[model samples]
Target: MKRVASTLHQGALLGLLCIPVAQAATGDAGSDAGTQASPTLKAVTVTATRREESLQKVPVAVTVLDGETLERDNRNNVSSIVQEIPTLNYRPSASNKDSSLFVRGIGTISTSPGVEPSVATVVDGVVYARPGQSTLDLLDVDRIEVLRGPQGTLFGKNASAGVLNIVTRDIPEQTHGYVDYAHYGGGDENRLRFGIGGRLSDTLKGSLTTSVGRYDGNVENVTNGHEVNGYERKGVRGKLEFQPRDDLKLTLIGDYSDGENDTPSVVVKPSAAVAAGISPVVPGNSNRKISSDYKTYVDDRNQGLSLQADWSLANDFTLTSITAWRGWNNSQYQDNDNLAALPVTAVHDKGTVDYDQLSQEVRLTSPKGQFVEYVLGTYLFHGKSDETYRRLSVTNSVGNTGVADYSATNDSYAVFGESTFNFRSDLRGIFGLRYTLDQIEYDHRRVSTSAVEVNSIRPSYASSGSHTDSGISGRVGLQYDLSDNLTSYITYSRGYKGPAYNVYFNMQATDVQPLDPETSNTWEVGLKSSAWSNRLTANLALFHSKYENYQANFYDVVGTSVVTRLINAGSVTSQGVELDYALQATRQLKLSGSLAYTQARIDQFACPSGAAASCDINGKPLPFTPDWKSFVRADYDIPLDNGLDVELGTDYSWQSKVQYSLDQNPNSEEGAYGIWNASVGLADYSKGWRVALVGKNLADKAYAPVLSTGTSTTRIVPRDDRRYFGVQLHKDF
Candidate 1:
């Protein structure tokens, strides 16, 4: 029955991807409205506010990536693409479709399948509930915005840390479309995609996009007796626009994706060996499966629909509405170990989540000429999330105990606002606030196979908790125009993270205790400059953050389950400095590089059991955080005749050591490593067509992005370390 459901879901996902993009409506009038406009080194962005503004004029710290950059890097997946961005990291896991993300050394690490991500991802206007589902294939991307500070006022829930806003191209007012195809050698891979957009009438426009990709697993699965860790992905999306009047605009967007693949089930190597009656290999070096009886497999399906509307009732008053619905199902089974050299056991885990969200916002702003240039808004957001999970343990030495199940239903809402006043043009200040309410309920049960009856080890717990935390998270920024090409600024701000249901629920079921809410206050100062004929640009920032009521999670001594808890953790401090520089050495050559250095630690934290005088990580660096990281890229365009173009570009990223576990396992620490990526392309922008040869991770470096804690070191999710040569072709018609 389970297999049948998975098969059906996979088929539906594939069917969506197979739709032809050209069949979609394409009669829009504004599709080419700005194509002939003068281009600049920076683009205008609107996610920070409800209105469009130039990036340089925005007072926030942000990272922007345009469509050209995404295609040049050949990063179709969000998880894979974020690795190139500084201060962002993803931890790979087989049981979940989405990886975990850490920003500025803070994030959640859990396989519970029901917890909300600390970082939030917004596509179009909808806020995705889970990271895995939020990372589906991106189609018709216009721009991506990464806001680095706390966005409590604008983004609300899960914006405790930061926000990632993704905007897709609105259906062009004019007729236009593109078809792209790529072939990758060494991985038996191929990818094809096409999209079209245009106005159906003066009041309506629409677009359709679809893509499919196939690739072989890089790992050789000796246990399965064939390759078992590669995958295939297919996805499709549709969008429509309706403008009934000059003051009202509405958009509807829908997307779906399905994937089928084989993956190695991860397990504790030493435990697997003991269960299989095999000798244990040295920690970290040993490759052993926890289960050998069954092979690991994965089936993932995702779908979402969103509605957005903008209504400008008056010259300075506007209202916005965003409604979202998303569903996801992820299933997996594995031998639980990367190596089959020794006897092993296998485990099976499956889960599903369905989510719905509704958000409404109304803003009142002053006309441009007013000295009181301000933005005042009130927002209400509500989301309902449901999740179900099941786990089964099977091994040669241990028999299956049927399956254990856990389910949760979460409902949450928030109201927030922000406003700015230009005391003077050069000295502007802002203030913001947010009020929130969330309720989470859980259902846990165990099934007995012999009698087919369900028994409850724990009674169903339904509790409603409310927290009204109001903080002034705003910035005081002063911009000084030193010259026509140079600008500098110094800014200071405060941020916070609201309490979560996960803390309380985790405490009810685990030995680790839960504590109060976690919060942080940060201060930052920065300088920006552009000089030398707009060919040279440099930015530097120094920041310090103080964390209080820090949250911590650890495993029980038996290591069978994770315990949720918190501590005052005294007060930890993180101070960092960063420098980004870009220089145009010549008209045909450009060099850019960025360097980052951060030191984070726990000033005071008690032991898990509260008995030990000395602990594993009292003053050591936080886990999964690198101390020093840097990136460099160079692009050179060769001079050619007859309108031909030849361009070459390469980038390199490296990081210092990072702790993998709280136990302070030296063997599990990640060492400094680097990968080389390069691309070569042809054709001129004036023709609207180009082709490129690209290679990623050219060195094929072997490393693990994440590891689990246990009595013994085990469960390493290895990074893809294979080289692929691919050809990319894109054309606009």
Candidate 2:
């Protein structure tokens, strides 16, 4: 604790020192007369509070990335975006079907089909219930807003940690279109992306986007002289918007993606005792390579369709409805033993999931200039999902296999209202509340084909159950406009997540138990300022959150097999501070930076069923929770006498070390690392043509994104995309 305090103190001092430098460059104290007009900062508007408002006045901790910034940073996917967000982390497991997203150390480790993610992801006002669905490629995005801390009052359930809101480009009124193409090389990788959009008619518009990419594996298989982790993927998305009436709008979207790749290459690092009997493989010694005798592969397919409608009503109100359906299928083959000598054990697993959801919301809003501006709304959601999993294992010419099928039906309803009271010109009070009810029905069946003796010990099982839960979440805050250029706010909020069933059930029916709900309370304070004639903007937030009945997933050894189970752990606490700044130093140069510090620890916890020992983890930091993270970015543009523009930009980011597992195993630790990227571009706006050259990981830093420890060996997933350069071209018509 003392070390963390010291680090925070030092950071604070550094930030204070920067103020003078900024003042010296921009003359901060010369504005007393208010005679010289200053350039107004670009207005930033967001819908984080369920209504459109200025980001500086929303009284929430939110980070907004505009389309131009995203393109400049090469954040075309969720995984890549995590590199710039201080509080976000994306860790993909070996299966590749599940992606764990941690926000401020409060995130779900389980990837079960039935479990809900703590951090909710919403695109174009439609929530994606599955984490895998949130990993889709980003295309034609207008803006993205990341709201930190609990946001249950407005975003609905499964938002105990935070929320990721993505807004795609909307149809324009004019008949215009654009085409873009990009090619990437080096590191034995290639990617191509293109898109076109335009108004189809006076009241109709549409867009189509597609991308195809391939990467030759960097790791070599010594046994076969072939790449072990090479893969290719392609995706296409189409959207149509119809505006039949001035007050009504409708949109239709369809998308599909397919990918095939070799199973991830995993290097085994056995303990000394375990290595005495077997050979140990070091990562860097052999160019971080590995050898597998089995010819393993993974195939994945995803498709989705959605429809949204919005209608403007009288009294400044609106009505919205969203209907969506999605499907996923994945198959994998692997050598479980991870040895080249012989295939002592091999496994094949396949899963398919189908989901459909319908949601409706109606909101009423009062005028903004009134003494009290209020918003009231009611929400309804209904969803159904079905999943099937099949696994086969072979050893010593004998095979063991099992098939588990699961299904779930869910219905949820909520009523919420929020109001802001303007006591005076510079002071305001805000309060909001939401009451939610959720009901879920689940069913599971498992069948196995094995010897009679094995079947007797682990027979087929079936179970069916239902659960209903209700909760209340709310927020209270106060905002004070210190001056025309500055504002400060403090808030307290509560968040909730509903109960869920264990989706990976393969044992006796009795072993399939439902986990309880989880809740969090957070307190936060923030400051937002625009200074130096709007050339500089800064935002800072400090927060603390306490959680109860935190849902956790762990491996449980039942009889002779291992299975994942969800349980309600006791308590946890997280405290953090975030800082963001943007400066338009001059007409040609722009700079931006962000920094974060977090201390998340388990307040109380007990070992689960399959733990190495029954020990307490009281004070241990959460997995993947780094203590410090920072980023710096700069962009400069130069105009030539020939009406051409040349732009140069760069980004650098770094993070502290982090543990990979709940046990905090020393062997599962990943060291801190930094990455640098740069780009150069030329544009002729009058001719509607532009081209750019981009490079990533220019320093060629090597690191591991994920690591895990097994009974006898440790598995590490290394990121080998050391360096890559790409070219992009765009044309408008």
Indicate which candidate wins on TM-score.
2
> Candidate 2: misplaced stretches above 4 Å?
1-42, 228-230, 261-265, 271-287, 293-298, 340-343, 450-459, 505-510, 558-563, 711-720
lDDT of 2: 0.73
Residue-by-residue lDDT tens digits, candidate 1, 1-733: 6378446634533332222111122222133322444222332465665457755556566666666678668777666655566666666666455366666666666544334565678887567766777656777788888766566666645465567788888788898888898887765667889899899998999999998988775544444446545678899999999999998899899999988766554443355534343233233332422323455666778888878787776665666776667777766564433334332333344555555555554555545655555555555555555555444443453434344445545455555665566666555555566655555445544453334211111223333333333334544556554443444556555555544444232223432222345667767666555444344556566677777766545443212333334433445666676666666666678887766666777776656563222365667776677877777889888868778789999998888778866556675577777778899999776777889999977987755666654424544434345566789898888
- Between which residue pairs do clashes occur in model 2? none
Best by lDDT: 2
lDDT per residue (tens digit) for residues 1-733 in model 2? 7498567756763574355345646565444423444434477889998788888778889988887577655566676687778888777654555677788888887756666789888887767776767766676788889999877666644477889988887766665567666766643656666677778887899988787777766666666778756668889888999999988889998888888776454655554533432334454412345555666666777777778887887865566666666666666565544556433444455666666667665566666777898877777777777777776665545667778888887788888888899999889998989888988888888887853324112446788888889888888999998776678899998888888777663645444677777989999998887666667778888999999988876555544444455778778899988887787776688888877888999999856655553346689888888888888899899999999999999989888888877767676677788989899999999998889998988998877777666543344343334777888787878
List CA RMSD, all candidates: 11.4, 3.7
Error of 2 at 337 (Å): 3.5
